[model samples]
Target: MVNLIYDKSPIFLQNIFISLKGIQIYRQRYNKVYRKELKILNEENEFNLQKKRFKSFIKYTRKNSPFYSQKLSHLKKEISMSDIELLPMLTKDEIREHVDEIVTRNKGLLPMGTSGTTGKKLIIYSHPYDISRRIAYLDYFKAKHGVKKGMKRASMGGRTFVPEKQKSHIYWRHNYILNQLLFSIYHASNENIIYYIEELNRFKPQSIDGVTTVIYRIAKYINKHSIELTFKPIAIFPTAETLTVTVKSEIEKAFRCKVFDQYSSSEGAPFIVENDKGYYDICPATGYYELERIEGNIYEITVTSFYTTTTPLIRYRIGDAVELFDTLPENYTQSDIKIKRIIGRKNDYLVSNEKGKVYSAILSATVRKTEGNFIECQFIQNKMDEVIINFVIEGVNDKKTIEHSIKELMKVRFSESTEYNVRFVEELESTDGGKTRFIINNLNRELS
Candidate 1:
């Protein structure tokens, strides 16, 4: 019944319904507790502030969460800063098996689902307090770049508001309460891109936010068609995917504005914000990050988010990895934890007959050949020796030249014996959450 109204309702009424829903989220996200978190964003301390947050979160979890109570029972009730590492890391499987026990609060909880980009998806619960603080942290990052509350925002999130059978160029809905213009990523195909560009010009948004890949696709169209937009956004903030230098450069060139990249997952991990100087700085007040060495300079991210007290993420293995300096730096939460590239999922890698296994970092760089004359591509590796490349080429570009270049590049990376089948498609498919997955490694988990 609700689905019927959502699909059949007029755009104005739909916007009203969406805004009403936004009011519910706005209350939870921008409350009194969020105001305090915004202040903490600028609080000065050498290291004591982050140290204090960790201890408080640990103390709260140890006292309230039944799972953590027994898990950390052996340690002193007052776990010291150094003893943080002593706490066992939380995995997705463990959280799934013990969600009820892991949650500290039963009432006033919000359930956020993980994207499962890494093959593991679970529902994470958050208290209103944590949810508000998390929003504060994100808003603080946006504010620094001139996107404040109530400003018009054009977002390309996973909003499937438009019915699939609808036949029209109109692909967006407005949320007036938050002053947000929600664009449908589902309808962002090449044919519908003109509508997006026209609507964006008409809406004149102050800032554009959402999935990095979705925005990248749109930017490619603007550049390919040489379409000049009338309204320039103050900033383009891309989330949920790894941003290569090449991808960032193209987005900036298209919008004639700086791209501020920020990182946080659906599960509410700590914020890794790209500063004005283009460095990815971990916001200490938001969470405590630990690295579990995978090999060489690559390490998986484990976090203890301060706001996730409802479902404590103490030493949680978040399934994403990053490249770091040879000698990792240590500091109290008062300072920034600088990071290099955010590599792809820890389990995301392609099998190479010669190279054995090519992880996401290498694969990201490998796809850099699509910088021009190609919008985007997804690599589907179903067999060790066979790989299918599905890509969308720029409308005016020569297809033969792009195909030859891609196959030639893959030969060097995957060896001469490897099969590289490249095909051109009008629209590339997105992940379940409306994210453009660069690679989908479907090889059996145990084998890969």
Candidate 2:
């Protein structure tokens, strides 16, 4: 009779409800413990201990990781901390070339796919300990702003892979279980924007995290129409792309919260986070980060994660460019470094209709040639024949001259008869996660 009751319809529903509620309570308890542990780790001297741990991690990676071992094969066993650059920088191509060998055979490592914004998706494996450390870092940062556990977090990102026809209440409950509200970036239309706002108001999350473009678009909608959002979030963390001062200002105004810009990549470590003081702080436990110049002041960012075990990326060249500061600030710890701005990826290049290619650096230089601050730019190729340049100009300038110069530059590079369409926008957008995509090739073309 008891078994029959357990298997029955209404009784089963009750059982599920009870189980879910219990899980939520358990999660709250776990978060409390996690916060306590993180509080201890946030102490000043804790960073020094983390550095020692990082050194051991370096030694372990060199010994266990084949990819790092091969790259740093030339280095002496007694290499000092300053000799980190002696290890050859690993490129995206190199990682893709040796994906299988790069990943550890350890079962404890969790494998995840890269966002594939650059091109093809790459597989990355990280240890459980690494994941825990990452979570801890996040907790410590959130604690600084008093964002404790049980506070709702709204994430605007890739679509949840669940069936779309599922009931909204069910989906909402699932997200709530995870302490997150997942907003779809793929559907950022006006209708979806309203829906997102409604959901956000209902959830009343403490923070909003997503692609910068999507967030900016939402903010623009709210501002243009004067939509007064009743619910205010504590913080907005933008990730995945470059967050310009303009975009940051807009997001801060709309969300009514301090915008924190995160400089990180899926391939490497989550290295830097901006504090309340507008200074970028390096995540000491994440990795040993370095800025190497290929030419002059233009530098390539490199990172070697101490927490990674599945695939230790030693001296990995993350392709992005950065402007480095000469001296560290007094307020910042010795491990912390100041990065003026992350320019763009080295591989981010625009291909002309004539089959010639122009890198992002060239595009940036060309924009500068017109004597204007190019906030952000993206090249959209609809077909092989049609190319559109969408960019934002900083100051009052002759749009025609700037457009003409870009066309001339493209023509000089390609040597092909190409039609150039330039759209000068007031502001370029970023994804909700605060990432700016410079060149989006929609021509259904693949780079060989």
Task: Tell me the TM-score of model 1.
Answer: 0.76
lDDT of 2: 0.62
Error at 94, model 1, angstroms = 0.6
Model 1 over residues 17-86: C-alpha lDDT tens digits? Answer: 8889889878878888988878877665515667888888899998999999999999987776677768
lDDT of residue 409 for candidate 2: 59
Deviating ranges (above 4 Å) for candidate 1: 44-46, 329-336, 345-448
Q: Candidate 2 regions off by >4 Å?
A: 1-40, 44-50, 67-79, 115-117, 161-174, 294-298, 325-336, 345-448
RMSD of 2: 13.8
Candidate 2 per-residue lDDT, tens place, 55-166, comes to 6766776687676677667777755456665667777677767867776565765666552433223568865455555666776777677676558787766432223333
Cα displacement (angstroms), candidate 1, residue 396, comes to: 49
TM-score of each: 0.76, 0.66
Q: TM-score winner among the candidates?
A: 1
